[model samples]
Target chain A: MQEKVHVSGGTALSEQDVHSGEIFMTEDSLDCAFAWDTGVAINRYLTELKNGRIIATECRHCNRIMLPPRLFCELCFKPSSGWVYINDTGVVNTFSICHVHWDASRIKEGEKPYLPAVIEIDGASAGMGIMQLLGEVEPEKIKFGMKVKAVWKPENERTGSITDIKYFKPI
Target chain B: MAILERITRNIDNRFWDPGSEAFPVKNRYTAGMAGQRFFKEIKENGKIFGSKCQSCKITYVPARIYCERCFERLEEWVDVGTEGTIYSFTVVYKTKSGKPKESPSIIVAVKIADGLLIHRLNGCSVEDIQIGMPVKAEFKPKAERRGGIEDIKYFKPL
Candidate 1:
């Protein structure tokens, strides 16, 4: 014998069919927490940030000095060659003016749009860049290949985070 | 050994480093098929409904589409009473963000027939709540009703 399935309300499956006694709906809230280890290279990189210095790891086999340092080279499949201090100045590779917040909420009236940009660090290999916020310049005036420098927060206020370098401003 | 010690020393006492932090995530959830119907009944009709498994003769509060014991599809729906007895309770003093609230909130697991309904308890003090205490759901006014368990403001002493 064939099994029969009966759904609440009627035989219709559309969302509109849920209007009255048909479809019952409810909402629930859940919270999850996690802890992550940043490991060796990044640990040292963040430490350098506290001292107001920018550093990168060099991949000996590939001859590339990468920022936001990693212990192993993705391209060469080898351990990093060594650590090197890099200049805080960089050139903007690309950028966007966002009117929406990270949570998708609309920016309130009179607030400036967030400016995020990809910056190619001066001492790293060509085409190597990291995404960071851009500030102190009008959105319309920002241009590709614009020279910028990291604006460091006061040493006492620095917490060894990317925010330690407050933002990149046009030089 | 020297290099390893240097690396470890650099990382020591850096627990409060903002750079070494993980981002928090927020998620929203929707009640499945059976829950949708159960909440709807309470919201629209001011009534509680349960799903019954004909095979096992078991009914589930806040209805489910299938029976847990018999693994049979539950097709029959029944109206359940709003009055129930408190099976368990707790006084919550902290908000989700870990901040303490000005006043404590009372949460209760109410035992109706078949299963339990967990909701906030109001109109009673923390000192007054007890196991097996009889209570009835107090729904929001009709004009204020907007479905979900919150449609019932809370359960109160009968």
Candidate 2:
């Protein structure tokens, strides 16, 4: 007969015991709050979005027009010189159909999977893109470099955040 | 760039109120070697046990498998009884939400044998508590305990 494993003070917990939740375990969290500081660059970029427009910064050092404008040129390692209006139109550079929420909860059955995409914005430097969602199209039809346009929320409802643009749709 | 000359120096002044967001994360903690026995005893037998380090001539609460100071293997178990003396204490007037409480609560560090256990002191007023005051552990009803610290509900004045 196998004696019941007793631990007066030895390693009594085997790998199987822990895996089966037979040992003492508890759930905890970081328990922290946070705030976001969208400095001079993204701050103004978001402000422009509230007015149903897009903007980009120009770095004279490298002659690049950067979307979601910031103060500095990342490549040239210098400050950006000026800002310019960028078009709301773009192309779907890449995308994925997500079956679950970011936290890993599944979407309700019969509901559509979210279409998160990276869109290369018009008037920005080559390869510069923004992460947005695609709507009003079938998941099976989404393709590379598909022409798309930003669908903005009404002016009165707009908040100075990325949500100002409701989504992107095929142009 | 004609726009460069007209750009104001304070580029940040024109923005709106700052936004806040959260990314909640989950975590887990497991009871290891010594804690397994310590908690199991409380959960199963409604008793508290501490490891006795004979060479160091000291005992630890929530017992350990090794002597922290002497580096000796502590195989002897000492039943540091539920009764104890108030080693230290404090009174709390603020709630977790930051509001001042109508009545303050007393917290005590009860020294059972040579081990110290920090827990709530109920069934007594704040003014009635003092260092070296005798107290005893009040175990929760048998069915309610799940082999954790909550097995002992609180320490009360004996």
Candidate 3:
């Protein structure tokens, strides 16, 4: 029997807000956030605390691991054939200081004005990483290739959530 | 795509909920008291507020606990005007429940007085609203406020 599927049509631009300096066309500014994918359900990693964990699917063919855990492997065009446990400790491969809280609801509720970083987990292959919050490290002290380790919640307190590890810290 | 689904029907839900049995129950996220109070304010008051950086004049709409500009802890709150302009927007044709509403809901990025807010646009037809159009914030009915994002309902043209 054949199965049915629903495909969402691409969204149309509903509005725009443009600003420009009266004196110069070079100063034109446009700011917009597309009303796309407001809600999503992605597979997240489980940590010792109630913190969420992010898992990576490894492709046996290429021995490549994918983070943000997708179902397929891009390297060998193969589906995820296996799963691997990743070490919580990693280095700050790259990071950014978010000066603005992008979402009003989250910001008003006090979700922003924090740093978001992408870390290369220890023992995880290159290109396999997790995006998470870092604590104990000041914003000014954060630097590229900084050694850090996951501070997992105590064994008795762990609940297979990312919050299990309160946050990462310098090694 | 159809072929993929036909072969994976049995495993679809399994793959979707690998860590389903943990925390606050499956699919449900719990917030702290502060978060709860924040949403309650949105339901009760039509106004939105952001944290103001004491060091810098930057205002974060939907306030932040810390200053984004100066990396300072911000404990003060300031109310932004309920009114703002549409920064960007889109009309959603489908909803999660499978049943579609008669009118397409317009979701917009509205620049409230202090910061930008993303919410649904109500009170007017989607055609009537345009980018850079002025709008005012309004609360959903008290009974309809679910202590969630829907609490504010949507922004409407002023």
User: All candidates' TM-scores?
Assistant: 0.61, 0.78, 0.39
* Docking level of model 3: incorrect
**Candidate 2 chain A: worst 10 consecutive residues by lDDT?**
A5-14
Per-residue lDDT tens digits for candidate 2, residues A1-171, read: 989977564556678976784587777777666555666778778889999999999998898999878778779778788889999999999999999987899999998999999999999988899899999899999999999999999999998888899999997
> Scoring model 1 with DockQ, what do you get?
0.19
TM-score of chain A of 1: 0.86
**Model 3 per-residue lDDT tens digits across residues B35-141:** 44455566567556666786788787766666656788777777776788999999888775668877688989998645788998888786687899998877777
Best by lDDT: 2
Residue-pair clashes per prediction, in order, are 3, 1, 19
> How do the residues A1-171 of candidate 1 rate in per-residue lDDT, one tens digit apiece?
897877555444565655553454544434444544556777777789889999998887898989878888889687787889999999999999999976789999999999999999999998899999999999999999999999999999987777889899999
Output the lDDT of residue B39, model 1.
75
Query: Evaluated with TM-score, which candidate comes out highest?
Result: 2
lDDT of 1 at A79: 77
Candidate 1 versus the native: TM-score? 0.61
Q: How many angstroms is residue A104 displaced in model 3 relative to the true structure, after the best TM-score fit?
A: 36
In candidate 2, stretches whose alpha carbon ends up further than 4 angstroms from where it belongs are A1-33, A74-77, B1-28, B53-58, B65-75, B113-115
Off by over 4 Å in 1: A1-39, A154-156, B1-11, B16-33, B40-48, B55-58, B65-74, B80-158
